[model samples]
Target: MIGYLVLALLGLFVVAFYAGHRRAVASVEGDVARLHSRPSQHGLYLALLSCVPALLLLVLWSLVTPAIEASIVRARFAAEVAEMSLPQVQAFIRDARAIAFGGIAGFPDETKEAAAALFGTLHGWSVRIAVVLSLALAAAGYLYGIARIAPAFRARHMVERTVRGFLILCSVVAILTTIGIVLSLIFESLRFFQQVPIYKFLFGTHWSPQSAFTGAGAEEGAVNTDIFGAVPLFAGTLLITVIAMLVAAPVGLMSAIYLSDYASRRVRAVAKPMLEILAGIPTVVYGFFAALTVAPFFRRSGEALGLDVASESALAAGVVMGIMIIPFVSSLSDDVINAVPQSLRDGSAGLGATKSETIRKVVLPAALPGIVSALLLAVSRAIGETMIVVMAAGLAANLTINPVEAVTTVTVQIVTLLVGDQEFDSAKTLAAFALGLVLFCATLALNIIALRVVKKYREQYE
Candidate 1:
């Protein structure tokens, strides 16, 4: 029903646009030069007036309808719900809604069937009320806006102001969302800190949340704070990120240089897209390749070379993650390198420099900031990757830096802690938020450092 109303509003908006456009021309007897704004601006203003208010009404209606329906159903079946707990009441409402909407319900009884029937009736009435009121509002807004269209009307100004306000609202929303996330992480991490000290999480050597006190009511269960030591997780994350950068940075940078300076147009058109296809492949598929192919290949090769390699090792995950990030680094670096003015290369040639010398001495220095930024961004991507790590690097949480050994990153540990139904108040689950907070801080710091590096090099180049 709501979808139908939205489609109707869209149609009305289109009609309003053409109507306003014609009205603007008709208002001034086809003397568009006398009007303050263009016919298109008038049309846009009318369209926004027609649909914006109706869209807001529909949003409000959608939020209110479920609550209103749940209340009416509960009041009608008061006797059935009187003895139920809050969760049970919520469950009953859910089941009734599901049954009314042709969804599969958990437990459908005669009481629930009656509730579902009532729910369907209420939903129909509510949708009718919403549609009628929304359409009326849209019609009224259209009439008012059209009536206001005159020779002196500033439709462009009004439309611009509305768009500007919308952009500001979007920016505010993004900032607030970031602030909210950080605050929530801090709040949850503080709760985890109450269970386990911050110092232990920061400095202790071991990483074993499985043995930590995770039960809600068991006071007798040993709360081993030392097991929550995150040092090993940090080491594993650093090890993997370093390995990934080792594989990605030089190779991606060299490929970008080749593509930007050496490759012909024909070669670039084919090679660049083929290289970028790596980035388009799903990370889960990369994880599978890492697990099934890369890890096993490494293990077999290790045996041949008289080396011991874990079946699920950090080396495999890091290498595959590096492969995944190659496109990101290569694309960014290629664009940056290409952005270096041709005059710089021409000047270098005028100085009797060879192509290799000009590239090494001039082009690379000019593009260093962007190249560094790309590599840092790739590092951030590597640090956040969980699938490849989870599949290739086993959840051993070993404090070793050996790439051939099994190790888990901070992201993997965070995921491991939060999987399935969890008691949020327990140290185990809260630990995920704690790890998240640390990761967020680390990423933010990395970005700040990258910005500084970019600024410094950019100043020199400029």
Candidate 2:
């Protein structure tokens, strides 16, 4: 119904725009420059004046209507629901609303049926009232705006102001959303810490969150108190990320240098896209490749060396993840390196430097900041990866630096904790948020370091 009303408002906007443009043109005798604003501006002003109020009302109605309906329904059946708990009454109201909307009630009752009928009647009346009020308001606003559409009216200025406000609103919304997410994570993590000691979660060397909620009517003692330690998850995540960077950084950097300087235009044209194809492939496909092919190969190679490698090991996941991130490092670094001033290379050559020496000393120094930023981006990508780790590195929170061992990352554990149906208030569930908070912090710190490094190198280059 609100959708229909919004569509109707859109139709009215078209009408208002045409009407206002025609009136403005006639008022100015088609000499638009003489007027303070153009016919288009006049039309836009009319449309906004006619539609914005009605749209706002519709939004307000949508927000307030449910609570109003719930209250009225509760009052209508107050005696019948007097003995019910607040949750029960709320459930009944919800069921009644569902029934009114043509859904079958799962638990039917006379009071609920009565309330549902009352809801249908009240909702119909509310819709009728809202329609009349919105249409009348739109009509009044349309007429008011048209009356004010004089030759000297500053309609363009008004539209610009509205546009500015809209942009600010968008920015504010994005900022607030980020703040809300951080606050929610912090609040949930605090609740988790209340149940599980923060020291144990952060510094302890064990992890088995399942023990947190193992049996019915369990006490804190039943929760393997030693198991909530997150050091292993952090260690695994870092170890995998390190391996990925070790693979990606040198190879990707060298590839970028080759494409940017060494390769012929024809070779670059073909090779760049082929190399970037790695980025386009889905991570799940990589995971499948890692699990089926890479892990087995690593196992066999390790066996040949008599090195007892796990079938699913950090080496397999990290290597595959590194392959996935290579294109990011290659493509971004290539672009950044290409952006370096050709004058620097020419200056180095003029000073009797070889091509390789000029590239190494002049071009690389200038492009170092962007290259560092690219590597950091690739590292973040590697850290947040889940499927590749889950499939190739089995979900064991091993605190070892050994790349041949099975290990799970923080992201994998966060997904594992929140995957199934579970109580949100439970320590087990809230631990996901704690892990998320830690992960967010780690990523944030990496970004800060990247920014600082970029700033320092950029200053030196400048």
Candidate 3:
């Protein structure tokens, strides 16, 4: 019903726009120059005036109606609901709503059925009243807007103000959302620290949160401190990220340089897209390629050389993950390199520098800030990647840096720990949030590095 009402409002706005447009034209007597605003602005102003108030009212009604209906139903079924706990009563109300819509998840009493029928009837009447009121409001707005559309009307100014207000609202929402996420992470990490000591969690060698009690069953100091150690996870994450960067940086940068400086127009057109196609391929597909192809190939080659290689090795995962992220680095670097002023390259050439020297010393230095930003972004991506690491590197949080052995990343562990309907209050589940905090900090550090890098090299180019 709400969906249909929204559609009706949109249809009304469309009609109002065209009607207002024709009325504006008639008022101007085909002399558009006489009007302070264009016919389109008049149409837009009318549409907004007709629709915005109605939409706002509709949203408020939608929020209030459910609470009002639930209150009435609860009042009618006061005796029955009073016997249930608050949570149970809330669940009962949800069940009643579901029953009213003709789907029963479970059995209920006759009083509940009576309540549901009354709930459905009340809800139906409310929808009808709301829709009628909405149309009336829109009609009133249309009349007011049409009367206001004169030779001296400032539709464009009104429209611009409305748009600016909307933009400010969107900006506030985004800022609030980021603050909320950061606060949630901080609060959850604080809870986690209360259970496990921060020193042990951050610096201890092993990670076995499963062995520790997660809730009130835990005493003030009863939790296993050793198992909560996060050093291995952090180590594994850094190792894999470093390996991925080692693979991505040179290859992506060289590709960018070649494409920018040497590749012909026809070749660049085809090759650039072909290289970027790697980014479009799903990471899960990359995981499969890592596990079945890269891992096995590495294992066989290792065996031939009489070296010990795990079936799922960090080398395989890192290499595959690197291959997956190459497009990101390459694409960003290519754009940055292309954005460097051509005159700098021409000056370098005139100074007797070869094409290679021109690119290496001049273009690259100029594009350093953007390229550094790109590489940092890619490193963040690599650190957060879970699929390829899970499939190729295996889920053992090994502290060693031997690429031939298996190691798991923080992201993979977070996923593994939260795979089922586990109690979130448990230490094991809360560990995911802790890991998330660590990941957040790691990414934050990378961003700080990017800023410092840009600050350091950006001035040199200028």
Candidate 4:
């Protein structure tokens, strides 16, 4: 039944779109032999008119239906429980509501009877109300659009303006969503800082989030232990990121250089996409390989060399993350290198510089900004990566510099912080937001620096 209604709404929209287009073309053709805009634009204009309002209605209805049904059920229960004392009635009502929603399995017999009746009525009314209103709105929009189509109608211009508005709206929505995310992080971090002083949280050397968990009868003046020191986690993140950069930058840059500067058409064709296939592999698969394959090998090798290696080592995770980011760095670097004028390379060759020297002195310097941007992008990916770090890097949050000794990262901390049963207001959970804010700021700063470098280099060449 729902599917049929949706199909009917769609069919009405299609009809309205065709009607608006035909009217637009007819009006324009009568005024002049050639229309100001193409007939396709007229069709698109009508399609937008036909669909926009009805789609908006459908979206609005979907969002509100559940809330409306819940309210109706709650209200019904409130009325039914009026005879009982306030506290007992409230408790009974809460349990009854939970039972009705399948949250709890059993309820008092009287409460159950009342709840079932109320829920049935609420569900039936809400569904009928939503379907009727949605269809009516869609039909109304179609008819209104048909009525407006006439000989003097400027449907082409109207449609173009509507399309422009839609594009602007989409862009605004994206920007607003980003702003909302940052604001949410800021607010949550503020709550976290209220419990753990911001200064201590940021610069503390130990990262035992368990310190935030207080036990019964814990002394107030005694060291309010739950080591919130974030230094080791940050260090682990930086160390792994550096390792990834070391692995990815040289390899990705070399590949980009070959593709952009040296590779023949055949070589480029065969190799570029093949390298991209690395990016397509799921990070979870990389996580498995890190945990199951690489870490054990590193452990055995370290033992042979008379060194201790943690089973879940940062090196294994970092290497795999680097492999994951190689395509992003190589592909972007290749495009930017290719975009550099051919004349510059030719001039270096004319000066009798060897190809390698020319590449190092001329091409690389010219593409430095773009290369920096690619590296920064890779760094951002490394820092934000969660799955590989969580699976391979032990969650102990050790405050150590030794890569072979298992250390955690900010992302890993965030995962463990909120993964299990957690209260939203607890210091442990809120710490995730604080870490997120710092990570966001760090990545944002790197991106800004990369952009500045790219801009400066572009100016130098121009």
Per-residue CA lDDT of candidate 4, range 1-462, in tens? 456767876786677667766776676665644655555565666666666776777678768865665566557677666777877665665665566656663446876667756766666676677678777776676667666665555667887788789899999999999999999999999998888888788788877776655543447533343477788888989988987888899999999999987999999999999999999999999999899998899999999999888899888888888898999899989988887888988999999998899889988888888889889888988999988988888787777667787878998888888887888887778889999999999999988987887788678666
Q: List the residue pairs that clash in candidate 2.
A: none
Residue 219 in model 1: lDDT: 58
Q: TM-score, each model?
A: 0.94, 0.88, 0.92, 0.88
* Better-scoring candidate (lDDT), 3 or 4: 3
Cα lDDT of model 3 by residue, 48-85, tens digit: 99999999999899899999999988888888878899
TM-score of 1: 0.94
How would you encode candidate 1's per-residue C-alpha lDDT over 254-372 as one tens digit per residue?
99999999999999999999999999999999999999999999999999999999999989999999999999899999988988889999999999999999999999988888888
- lDDT (tens digit, per residue) of candidate 2 on 1-462: 767988999999999999999989999888887889989899999999999998888778878998998899898889998999998888899899999999877798887888999999999998988898898889989989999998999999999999999999999999999999999999999998988889999999988888775644566445555678999999999999999999999899999999999999999999999999999999999999999999999999999998999999999999999999999999989998888878888889999999999889889888988898889988888999999999999999989999999999999999999997988988888999999999898788878888887777667656
lDDT of each prediction vs. the true structure? 0.92, 0.91, 0.89, 0.80
Candidate 3: misplaced stretches above 4 Å?
102-115, 214-222, 451-462
RMSD of each: 2.3, 3.1, 2.7, 3.4
What would you estimate as the lDDT of candidate 4?
0.80
What TM-score does structure 4 among the candidates reach?
Answer: 0.88
Candidate 4 regions with alpha-carbon error over 4 angstroms: 1-3, 23-37, 79-113, 214-226, 460-462
Model 1: how far is 107 from its true place, Å? 2.8
**Candidate 1 lDDT trough over 10 residues, lowest sum:** 213-222
What is the full ranking by lDDT, best candidate first? 1, 2, 3, 4
Distance (Å) between predicted and true CA of 366, model 2? 1.8
